[model samples]
Structures are given as C-alpha cells and as structure tokens.
Target chain A: MSSPVTTKPFETTGPGKQVLEITDLKVSFPGLFKTVQAVRSIDLNIGVGEIHGLVGESGSGKSITAMSCLGLLPDSAVVEGSVKVTGHEINGTPEKQLARLRGGGAAMIFQNPMKALNPFFSVGQQMFDVIRCHRDLSKNEIRAEAEKALQAVQLPDPHLALKKYPHQMSGGQLQRVVIAMALACRPRLLIADEPTTALDVTVQAQIITLLRALARDHDLAILFITHDLGVVASLCDRVSVMYAGEVVESGSVGDLFANPSHPYTRKLMSTVPKLGLGEQSLDFIPGQVPDMSSPPAGCAFNPRCDMATDACLQPANKVLVVSKDTDVSGKHWAACHHVTGKKPSSETALSETLEEHNA
Target chain B: MSHLDQPADLLVVNKLHKTFTTKNGVMTAIDNLSFDVKAGETVALVGESGCGKSTVATCLLGLQSSDSGEIVVEGRNLLADSKAQGKSLGRDLGIVFQNPYASLNPKMKIKAIIAEPLKTAFRLRGVELQQRIIELLAHVGLGEEHMDRYPHEFSGGQRQRIAIARALAMESKLLILDEPTAALDVSVQAQVLQLLKQLQSENGLSYLFISHDLATVEFLAQRVLVMYLGRIVEAGTVAQVFKSPRHPYTRTLLDSVPSIDPARRDELKTLGGEIPSPLNRPVGCHFAPRCPRASDRCHKDVPQEITEQGHRFSCHHPINAAEE
Candidate 1:
C-alpha cells in the first residue's frame, strides 16, 4: 500500500467534454484455479455532467468494469487497456498516485452503505478525513466542508448526522452520507455502483435525486451502475448494457429503452414489472448470463437471444455499429448480427409489446 | 380459478399487537393489526421495510408472542396454553424467509435439509425418507436425483425450491412467505411465483405473501393488506386495493414502482427522506409527513376505518387530484 501522492486535478476542459474514457479495457483476477476474465475489452466514455448508466443483471460484469476504472480492483487483478480520467491515464499508475487520484480525480459509492461506512467512526470524522486527505484545508474548514457536503445530499440536520455513527443512519441516510463523502472531494467523476439497492423504494428515490442534483450542480461526470432500468431511464443520459464481460449495447437512454436493438436487451425489457403502467414482469431476459470461464464462441447473448442467427453463432467480427433508425442517428450501437431495421422508440417498444399480447 | 368467497378463514389475526421493549422505549412493531387469509387464498402484506410486515409473519407462526389481542389459527390460540401443553405449534404453519441463501443450512445436503422439518411431524424409514425427499424435489421442479446435491450446488431459484420443499414437508396448512422471491431475478422470480401459485391451487394451501413488489403481489394475492408503522392502514381485495388504492402510502408505493411505460415522464414522487424515526413516532397518522395529501386534520386527528364492500382505508383523507 502506498501513502498520499499527487492529486489529478478535476477537468480544465469546458463542460460537455469527456471526463473518463475507456478503450479496449480488459480486467482479470489471478486468484483461484483459472484466470477469470471479469471485464472484457470494453469501451466506455462519459462526458462532463453526463450520467452514463451501466445496466445489466447480476454477473453482467458492470460492477467490475466500474470498479476497475477507479483502480479499486484487488492487487491480484490484472488490468489492461487505457483508463483515462480527464485525459490522465490511471490504470498502470503507481499505488500512491492511484490512491491520491481516487478522491480528487474519481470517487465511488458502492451498493451497500452499511458496509461502506466504518461502524466505529462518526459520519463527521469520516467526511473530515476524506476532506483532509484530498484537500489542503484547515480543521475548521474541513468540518464546514464536511457539513456542507452532508447538507448537499439532503441529510437533514447535517450537524447531528455528522455526530452519529453509520449504524445510527437509515439505509437512505447512510447512502446519502456516502454521497456526502464522495462529494466532499468534489471529484471530476463519481462512480455509484447500485447505490440504492439496500434502500426502500422511497428512500431510493431520494438518493437518486440527490445524486442527479449533485452531478448537475457540479457538472460532474457520473457512472451510475444499476440493474433497475427504471433508475437508468430516470437518471442516465447515455446507457451501456453489459453481458458476459462485454458491452452488448450502448445508446441514449431514450433510444435504448424505446427501441433496444439487441435481442437480449428486448428480452430484458419484457421481464421488468411496469406497475400498472405497461409490461407485467421484471424484464426477465431469457437464459442465464453465459459462464465467463468458457463463454460462447459466438455472441455471448446468442444463447438467450430470440433472433440469433448462424452468423451470431460464430465469433463476433468486431463491435457492430448499429445504425440509429430509419434516419440513422448513429447513436445506438448494438453488437449483434441481427437488427436490420428501425430501433423501437419508447412508444413503439411498448405498443409492439402490447400488440404481441393482443396477438 | 373462481372467487374464494369463503367467510370462514383458515387464519384470522384480530387486533394482534407486538411491542418490543428495547431499553430506549416501547417499539410497537405491530399495532392493532387485523386481517385474515381464507383457505387457498394468497393475501399479500405490502409496505416499506420497517412497517412490521415481518413481525406479523412472526406472530402468525407463534415464534414471537404478541403483546395484546388474539391470533386464531382455526380456533387455536397460537399464544395460549401451548406452553402448558409443552408442545410446539410447528405443524400448521410454514415460513419462507426473504433470503434463500441464509435460510438454508450450507452444511446440510438438499435431501436432509428438506427432510429436517418432516422428521418432527412424521416418522419415515430410510427408503421412505429418500422417496419423500425425491418426491418433494420433483414437486419443486428439481430433478429427483438432486436429493444428494448440497444447497450450494444449486442456483438461487433452486435453493428457494429446497426451502419450499422443506416447508411442504411439514404439511403446513398456511404458508407465511416473507418476501420469498425478493432476492431472485425477475425471470427467475416470475417462475418461482408462478410455482407458488400452482402449488397453492393443487394443495389448496393458504399463503400470507409479503413483499414490497406490488406487481408480484397484485399477481398472486387474492386479498391485500397495506401495513404502515405496524398498523393495517388499508385492507382490500387485490382488485380493490390495486385498482383503487385508498391509502396515501399505498398510492405512493404504487407510483414509485419503476414503470415499463416509456411515455410516462419520470416525475415519480421522490418520497423525500427516510420514514421518521419509528422510535419517537408522532402522535397522529404515521404517514402524515410523507403523504402528499396530508392536511392539518391529518396531523391532528387519528382517522378511523371506513369500509365499503370489504375494501377499507384507515385515513381521514386519501383522495388525490388525479383520482378526483
């Protein structure tokens, strides 16, 4: 483990510019009997103030991808390819530099807040420590900074919350505290990995709103990872759906949700419960995610795909660039041999589904 | 397939109260909660996490004694005289916990784990036990030969099958499933829920299904009980509760459900903050702070129940602009 080092300062670039860029990024764990390819050569880039959602089912390798970006993966894990935050290369950097970059350049809020925050430490102490670690500020200034961050995430009575332990806070509150800690540093990029999974529906909503506000206010690039497409639709600008370590599709939230090009994406949309609004189930994708150990020779989702042809059964040629629509926006790209026509719009995706039900 | 208009209930909970005396103060986990599940009916108990839905499940099983009121399970006082008889009220009830992972013992093989509850109620020889275990495994959609596989050898859905098999082994008349499918993925969750529904019909078993997922509940529950702060805030048939939610809490929960309808703009009521600390609970309605339609009257007066055709809402006001 390395001590403190140089902080990779936040963006000097103008707004709407790229904050983090990943190209052919592959990560693997060297533990166990065989090397496990956790994150395949995946490409992802989030522009400043853009909410990029990594959506997929469990073991879809979304978390591993996000974790790898911050250099949060274990020492046994071998990472390859370029990971850049504000155009500063991160992955192969020394431990001390990487540690310094974590808070100042990038910050992460994990799924479970109870486990994320230390049980013994007061919320205030945790926030102050984070502030002091990343910023050269006085004790009183750090305390004020901590309080403001807590208040930013809408933790009522920030002073009291600071004095309280992690256990004393509710799941929602604890998550907000995590957000507060993350924001205290005001990193250029914030990676939230299922930050609301442990919270109640209502509490989850509050946390999502806080995150969105924080991103908008600070013009911070956010990598929001979640299984719930609803959250993705609500919070994200661009969305990337991962399966078996590789990105199956990436598109604007509206485009992806409306007309998901990949067959697996379509199947996924069918299973999620839409309350009384639309579809009935949690969009249940057909077939389980393929085992990464001996993944499919062809497309990973070909096993689960309803429209998979012989071409898909062969190894993917390259990341297939799916044209946007009849009037190709070129925004929606799906890695599949299928998808010959228009990507379904939100209205079409649903009405077409309703038509299938009626048929 | 038809409406189970059975007036006589298999399980009736009448004003059942469970208040725990934590050193800080009396935490009323379940307050004046009353509802019933008829034979073969699935009654979903839906609420936020700390709304005492789990406590109601506990009281039903006689695991936790209620502080006040009676729990009548087929005219049997679940609380009374069982201690004097030195008998455990283990047979009539079955419970499926939220996590199939934690509920199952990792060390035990699937056969023995499923057979653990049966040994108490019925005596079986080696062949008979093996046969029964095989039967249960098959019944739960597992291979009959899966009896030797340990719980770890199976997926989450399969492990839940093992749990269900154990519950069935006891021959429980009423099943208290506490968020059984919550841990499962939607596709797997759908299959498990469908299995539960099929098992209920075939065995004529009653289920007290508890879940935060309203769609799942709406699909399964014959009747629905809306709990808030350990109280039955609203109770109705599934059609009644879902089609016309009378309580604000139920309405908010429904609204919060991530919709598949893409046209529906996402101004979902971000129910701000956590539920006020359950310890120093306010004097009036528990949902007063969160309720969108909460009035000054709501903050001052405790609302009484107004019933219409078996659908009840305990609120001074539950109307929204959209409904009106």
Candidate 2:
C-alpha cells in the first residue's frame, strides 16, 4: 500500500518566532473537601499566524488550559507557572493590565453564541460595547467599524443584522456575528473553544473555511480547541493532546497522524468514522477518563491502554520527545516511554517492565 | 407502480406529503417523498437538521397526522385501518429517540419501563411479564441484576441498551431509530451500534434509520436515501450512492465531511447560501437555488426522477467521474 501523503508541515515558524508561550503551567481549584487539579504542569508554544490544535476528550484540561491563557478562569482556580503573550507575562499581571492585553492582544469566542452574546441587547450594541472598550473611537466611527466587521464575516445585510437580536438569527449567522465581534478587537491571538460543535454540517464547513482564511490573511495566531480529530487534520497545523490534566502528546498534524506512537492517540485515531466505506465496526478504547481529583500516578491512560505495564502505574517524567528518521521535520514529540527509545516497539518492553515489578 | 413491483411484506411509503402552517406561514415538510424498507434490511434517511426526517418518523408512529400520504405496514394500509386495528398495529412499530436521558423516566425502575409495552400490547401479567422483561434485557446485553436499578444509575450506553430493550419488548418488526447515538461518545457509540447490528441479525429485523451523520448511516444502512428540502434527491445502495453520487446535492453533502486522512486537507467545496426557508421555497426545484450546475432550465422546470439499474436520482446535470 502507498504511504499516506504527509500534508503541510505542522510547525510554520513565521517572521516572528512565537506569539504565545506557556511554561510549566498548572491550574487547580481549591474545593471544600479536596483540590481538583484541572491542568498539570505543561508547556506550549504557538508561532505567529499559526493555528494550533488542542485535542482531547471532555474534562481533559484542554479548556482549562485555554481559559488559563485568557485569564478567564474562576477566582477559585489557583494557577502556577508563567503565561507569556509576546514575551509579556500574564500569570501574575494585574487585572487592569490583563484587561488591556485581552482587549487588544487576545480575544476569545465561545461555543454557544446564544449564551455568549447578551440577550437583552441588540447585536449591534454588543459589538459596539466591545469595540468602544478597546478603542476610543466616536459614535459614527464605531458604528462604521461594527458594520465593516459584520461584512467581513460575510453576513447578509450587515446593517439589518446589527438591528436584530441574537434569537432572530440562525445558529450559523449567530456564530458569524460572534466571530465578527472577536475580529473587531484586532487581537493577535484567538482562542476558539468548540466553536462549530453546535452547528449543522454545512454551516460547520462554512465556519471552518472562514477561520482558516482569517488565520492565513490576517496573520492571526489561533488556539483551536476541539474534540474532533478529523477537524484537526484538515484545519490545524500543530496538535497537542491532553489526557487527565496533562498533555500526553504534541507534534505536527502530518507527523502525528502518519505515526501515532502513543496508544491513546492510536485508539482515538481508530475511532474516527470514515465516509464512502462499507459497513464495519470501529475500534474503541475501553473505560472513561479518570476523575481528576485523584488521578492514577504514572499515566492517566493506563487503565484504558492495552499496552500498559507496571511501570505505567508509577510516577514518570512528564514528556519524552521521540523522532523518527523518516520524519525529517524532527518536531514530533511523545510522552510514552516505549516510543522514546527506552524500549523497542515489540511486546518485550511490557514483559521487561512486568519482570522489574515482580523483582 | 403496480402491486407486483412493490415489496408487499415490508413497510412502503408512497406519495407522502406533509405541510405545517407555522406563524411565519405554511411550510411543506415532506414533498412527494416515497421509499421502502425491505424485510431484514436497513434503510437510512439522510438529510440536514430541518429537512423533515423527524416529521416522517412522527407520522410513521401515528403521533402526528400527515397532510396526505399512504403508509403501508405489512400489506396493511395504516391510514385506512380502523381505530381498533390501529391499537393492535402499535406492536409493529417501535421508535427510539436521540436522547435516552429524557426518554426514560427517572422514577420508574428498569423492569417497569420494559414491561410498559408488553403489558399494554398483550395484557401480559405475573410470571409471563417478568419472563419477557428478562428475555428483553438478555437480548439487549443487560442482565437480571440491572432490572432493579433506575435509569439514572446506568451510563449512557447502558441506558440506550435499556431503551432498545423496551423497543424490542413487543418483538417489533420495524424499528425507527431517530439519531439514537448522536448524544453518545465515540467509544460508547461503537458498542451501541454493535449491539444494534447483532440484534438485527438475530431477530431478522428491519430498521428505518434517520440521521444527519453520514458516517454512522454508512455503517448501519444498506439502502441510502438522500433528502433535501422535504424531497428525496437520490436513492440507491450504500456502495452506489457513496461511491458514485449522481445528484449534485448528494455530492455536496458527502464532500462536507472531513475524513481521518491528513492528505485531503484542501479547500472544501461548499454549497452556496443557506437552506432556504420552507415557507419561501423556490418554485421549480428545491435544490436549484444551491446547486452549482444549475442552468436556466433547472430554474424553470422540475426534473423527474430518473431510474437507471436500480439506482434512482433527480438531477439535470450529474457530475461525471472526470469532473469529480
């Protein structure tokens, strides 16, 4: 069989090296009984004008990581480590400074447009509030900019949209309006969390196309968070997978899909249903994501992993970067011990690990 | 078509039309839709969100009255049948909706939920009723231990299994599965689908599967019906329609799905504009407004359904292999 063609290189370091960087970040909520560790120590980097994907199942700390970046997590969340946007720190920055950075440097669009946009106000009024908060433009200029933003999203009859309420528009139209508001701020980084999950298939295609174009033409750095790996294959350049509050794998989309070393990644890839194919059953990973309050020690995926060993139950290093000679990109990294050259890909490693446990 | 041409034993729908008078105006939900589900075969109704697939399900279950149509179940005309006969005919049809959480009652135990249909259909009671519920639980892969627990105690997959058991209580010949796995996770969805496939083979059941997800439909359905704006655009076997889609709308719908392969990450071929309001549908062909190959002729007159080698499609200009 022919080898699958490797698409675009995941890491596209543009003119500027990096736009957003996080080092050793961790987030936890201090509960009355026990602390809920939402995100473990993790590091990430997004280059200028690049679309980075954060892929994971629900409650996998993907959303919490993005929320930590935007400084939008609840006050009960206690965060550690450094979050830098353009080499400026946001971890311990004052609320006033963070607001300025968020209003100008970073913006976010949520999944539910109806909940994100206020119902009492008109669409135009919401857009105007955001633009006015970031800029000192007058009434007519603000209205003009709002109309331009709406038109940029290709909404039909921009002026009529501004006059209408959120309920009056369709789901696709409401999402376009949300994107229009985010772009109106002229932010360099956009964090969209499951933006198209609630839309129809045709409308989802339209939204994805729009986001891809915006990232290319506007030189915007995007952190596209979603649970669908198929979408990541088509849209994202680099992908990072999180499991149980830790990033278990990170690499370029091409290198990752062609050779997924981590068992969790492999199981996830196998579950994607294909089109134009005959009836067949799908391979599934057993069990569910562990409760984060008291996660297992070594690897969170051990319970569901078919290749788990005794070593997998104990504490280990956070991540181990693995590179194959065939992948000249040399950017592929996996956190699994077996794939990192500590042991071979055969069944021998598990027996060895098991022997060590017995000894 | 003559009586000899139609499949007599299976469920056959002919010239089904349904229109609703909404506050916006009157809207046609199903426009001259016709199809059939063969015995022991699965027929899928594929369409977008508001294309009237749910309306067809409601009309088939006799929950909602249709504007006009003929519904035939096991050679019996459902519309022309008497009220007393309709009550007995309920056992022939069983439906499972998308959300299992809302469908199952929180207060009712699993045994009572499964027995609800058995008791009403046959007035079965005492030891017979208990034995039937146990048999249904076993058929759906549940056990006797699960009979005492409530619906909230089970996981999503297990709850769906209970729902399936309830549907199969009356030994239903035809099951209407309306987006049954949409609310489930991928791994859970796989198990549920596997169970359904096994049940179909064991009981020789016929299924009318309705969903917007093409992937699941490909796995479950033997015959595929592509719907758009209340009309069947294409009808054929899964291999014929998916491998060589003749209708432009069918091609558009299939092209919209993002596959697992990373190689095919090029520009997506999207249809122009949104689905038009049902109240303000175009005059000639419903899809003429969005079709890429629409000529002046397409806008002026409706095209007839063309049948070629058991594959039927309605289109003025079908995309050839070279163009595709």
Candidate 3:
C-alpha cells in the first residue's frame, strides 16, 4: 500500500509508431449446417505503453479479435487479415515460429486463473519452464527473476507461493501468479481477457492498479478485453465498442463516455448503475445479439438500434467523418450510415435526440 | 431496535444460530441473526461469497435445520409440531438458487417442472394442472409454446423467468431469490429485474432478495442487511445505507466498485488480504483485520448493533456520528 505507483496521464499516441496493428481482420467458421461469421473486417492500432480496451457483450467478437492477434484460432476458423506485433506479422506464420513468438513476443492472460494454471505442477516449476523456453538462464538466475516477477505484482511470501500448487492459493493470489507468469518472458504486447471478472471487487481494484503500473513502468502495449465498461473507463486510454462482429464506435475514453454516438454504445453505457445515484430502473437495450450464422443484412445493429432509418437496411461501410463542436480526434468515428458525412449543424434534430444522457 | 410492540407479518426469524464442526474446529456460520419481512416488501441480504446468507435462506425454506431458531410464518412456528411434520410449510416458502441449470430438472418438460410443486401440494391434476401451468408461464412473461421446451432450450433470461414461474406456482407469500441475475448479462439482468418488479406488484408477494450486486439491491429492495463474516453489520433503508454508509466494511465495498465516469473515480483504498477463513476467524469483530479505522476495542470486543433514526449499524466508529 505504501509503494509509489503513479500512472501516466492518458494521451493519444502519435501516429507512425504503432506497437500492435491489425487491418481488415475477418474470421469465419464454415460448418456443415451454417457458417458462423464470428469477426467481420475490423482494424485497430495500439502504441507502446498504451492500454487499449475492446468491450462488448457475449458473442460480440471481442475475444476472437484478440485471439487472432496470437494466431490461436482453431483450424476450422478462416482468418484473413494482417496481425503485426512489434512490427512483425503474426498471422499466416508456421506453428513452430508462432510458438516461439507467443511467449517471447506476446503473452495472453485468460479469465479463469485456476483453469489457466496447470494443477499438477507447482507454481515455480511452471514458471521456470516458461522462462527457460524464452531465455537461456541458469537455475539460480531463473529463480531470482521469477521471484522478482512475483514481488513486482505485490504477492506476499513469494518463495512460499512458488512451492504451493495452484489449488492451494486463493483466487486473488492465483491471478497474481498468472500475471507473473505472463510477465516472466517480458513480452512487448500483453492481451488480458477479462482478467479481473472472476475476482472480488477489492481484488479487482488491486489488479487494475497493478496493470496500470505495468503499462507505465515496462512500456508494454496492452489489449484489455472485457464486457464491463466501468473497468474500461478506469483502466483504458482508448476504447473500441463492438456489436455483432463490428466495431460500432472507437474513440478516446473521455470522448466516448461524454458524447457517445452509436446507439449500442449509448444504451450499453446506460445499463451500468452509478454508485451514489438514487434508486432508478436501468435502461436496457431490447433483444440480444443476433445469431452469427444468419445475421441480418445491412448494419448488424440496425434491428436493435433506436435510431435506425429506412436507409439503414442497406449495406454500410466504415467511415471517419468528423463531428462538429467536439474534441474528437479524426480517428474517433462510428460506423453508421445515418451519422456519416452529415455535419451536426444540418442534422441537429437527430443529433439532439441522440445526445440524450451519456450516463 | 424492538419489534415487540408491532404485529408480526408474513415471516419472522429470531435468534437464529448455526455452527459446523469441521476439521479446523467449531465454525459459527450464523451468529444470533434476526430479521423480519412484511407482507409485500423486499428485504435484501447483501454480503460477499460466504457470509451465511444462503444458510439463512435454507433454514427458512426448511431445507436445512438451524441449530436453534424460532421461525414463525403467519402466526405459526414453523419449527413446531403437527403441520410441520410433513414439511407442509414448504407451500408458504419457495427458494430460487443462483444457478438455474442446477436447480431445474433437465429431463422434465417445462410443464411438469412448474406443475411439480402444485401436484404435490394441492393435488391439481389433468386439465386443471395444464391450465395452471400455462397461466403461470404467461404470468412470468413466457408463453404456452414454451410449455413443452426443456430447461436447456431457453436462453438464460427465459430460464430464470421459468424458475420464477415455478417459485410462484404454489401461491407462496415469501420467495428467496439468491443472486438471480448474477449469471446473466447486464442488459438481460435489467429485463429480469423489471419482470420481478412487475410480478411483485401484481401478486403482492414478499421477497427475501440475496445478492452481492449493490446496484440491483438498491433498485429492488426496500431494506438492506449488510453481512460480514457471519453477522449483520448494517441494516437500514436503501437510501440511508447507500447514501451515507456507516460501517467501515460497507464503505470499503462501496468504494471498491468501479465507476463508469472517470471524473467520479475516487482514490481506491482496496482492502488488503482476503476474507479470513471462517474456521480460523479472528476474535471480536470479524471485519477488524480489514477495517482501516479498527481500534484495539474492535479486536477485543464485538461491537453491539447501534441504532439511530431507523438506521442500525455495528461498528466501533460509525461514519457521520457527529452530524447525527
């Protein structure tokens, strides 16, 4: 509690020095019955020392997009995209090279810590194996580095924890161990998928603080995947809101929270209850994410969006139209045919109604 | 602090105590717990993972016997003779667990599942039973078409609605809902909560809502009982407790919740260490180890519940005491 952990202020990364970049990423599972289009064409870029968030409900393709970066999708998946980590292409690489690049180049932490860690091996044994795979260090050197990683995450009794099995540790302690293992190789890019969803509120806060510090001190680029927008606001600098396999909106966290444009983003933000606010029924979006196999034509969110027009039934493409009277960077945009290319001055009626309440 | 002057309503539990002798030693799961639910009110039991909230529910439903308690329902002691001999009290109390997949029987049709309680309790058979099942389905926002569907066929929200319909089959006055919406997504959770509210108003049914989600508790419950370890640490109306939480543990929990607005993000002072093992609990206040304002008195003597302006809290140093 006394450690001096200061998070760097959030600022947009300058162009031309991206640490992780994805372009036109599309993943589909062709089955005998029907084809499940998991992820449509999408793009993303994260600079070094930045924490970028991918947030959506279940079956929103956020997890699959992250999996594509690691080339971990199953063989049945038809992936067509370019995934570059530290300026090296990861997709279409052979299994041997991908295995080598996985830990040393990039690492991923999953949701369930107990299931992620092997039950048979001690924590130290599994951690040493990862270190040995990435670096050629002596036994003493490896143990020292592992202890350092454990201590960096603020776990108590680092040496004793190494001797215990995964089942012997608490949920919070096990998560710290998983984080330590992920950081053992010092991978440049880290993909954490709902790492704190299974933890208690207090433990989640601690882990969030740790992640922020890691991004600052290690200069590591992170792709944080979660369904909770509250955690995204507190942790991420920039965010991408996905709905039914498409990025409906992408912008800085402040801009998105203040003036959300997409109907799904606005409705999703309203679902989260404020802590000090009085008792009020939450406003929830109607219906669920459509079945991936037979998605509707035109916009995927057109069926559920309240602002859908007659033109919304036709196909729409991505665009980066500039909004009026807002501090939105040119990259901050939404994929809606209704809002595209229309300045706020002319479309004041629709913009005013959609302005509503961001919360 | 005294309910002696008021008339008892639907459910009243007094001095409930439960303990287990495990490999570690004697562990007190419920320590002198007491609460009352009116005819049409929602009383929420808020706590973390293992705070004996579920144990209290089980005891009330007669699924598990308490070590010693006086559970009275509608002017009759549920722990006493005659009618209690055959567990007929179950007709008055119904409970829904966290996981619908486990609580529901997968082999049976939705019709048979909802009719199971009615068949055993009232012996309504044949056409009458079928009509009643369909009526229950409609009451919970489902339709007659879902009557033949199995538990696995419906979505999570639809399954929970079916579970609610089953709980209301016997015209039970009090329903115990344990984390009913925890497993569902946020938007779907709102839908279920709205349905619960609608049902409560229509049937005038009382609910003993148990959940760890504070926002849902604030929306649904008229009163809240905050539990730490195995004891009630705070009890008050939603406005009283949520606006100005008195206990240190309650304050910590509220602060730990992440806010969606970055400007409202307070400096988070997370509690160190996990909840102490129930078997090897610390002396005096169970929350003393984690409470930042805990004094030597908190570690030595259990603080008695203090009441002011209908707000009751157990703490050595309650917040906003000077203002009061």
Each prediction's fraction of true contacts recovered: 0.32, 0.54, 0.53
Candidate 3 collision pairs: none
Please give the TM-score of chain B in predicted model 3. 0.91
DockQ of 1: 0.36
Which model is ahead, 1 or 3, in terms of DockQ? 3
Off by over 4 Å in 2: A1-17, A29-36, A75-78, A85-103, A316-329, A340-359, B1-9, B81-90, B99-171, B321-324
Badly placed stretches (over 4 Å) of model 3 are: A1-17, A319-326, A340-359, B1-8, B80-90, B104-171, B321-324
- Provide the RMSD of all predictions against the true structure, rounded to 1 decimal: 7.5, 5.9, 5.5
Give the per-residue lDDT of model 3 (tens digit) for A1-359. Answer: 11221234444345445778887898999999999999988778888888889988878898999898899999999998888887788878999989988988889999889999999999999999999999999999999989999999999999999999998887888999999999999998999999987776778888988998899899888999988777887888788999888888887776667657777888888877666677687887776678899888898998988888887888664444454534343546677776544444444543342322110
lDDT per model vs. reference: 0.76, 0.81, 0.81
* A336: Cα error in model 2, Å: 1.7
lDDT of 2 by residue, B59-109 (tens): 888888887878888777787775723663577888888768888999999
Q: In model 3, what is the error at residue A281, expressed in angstroms?
A: 2.6
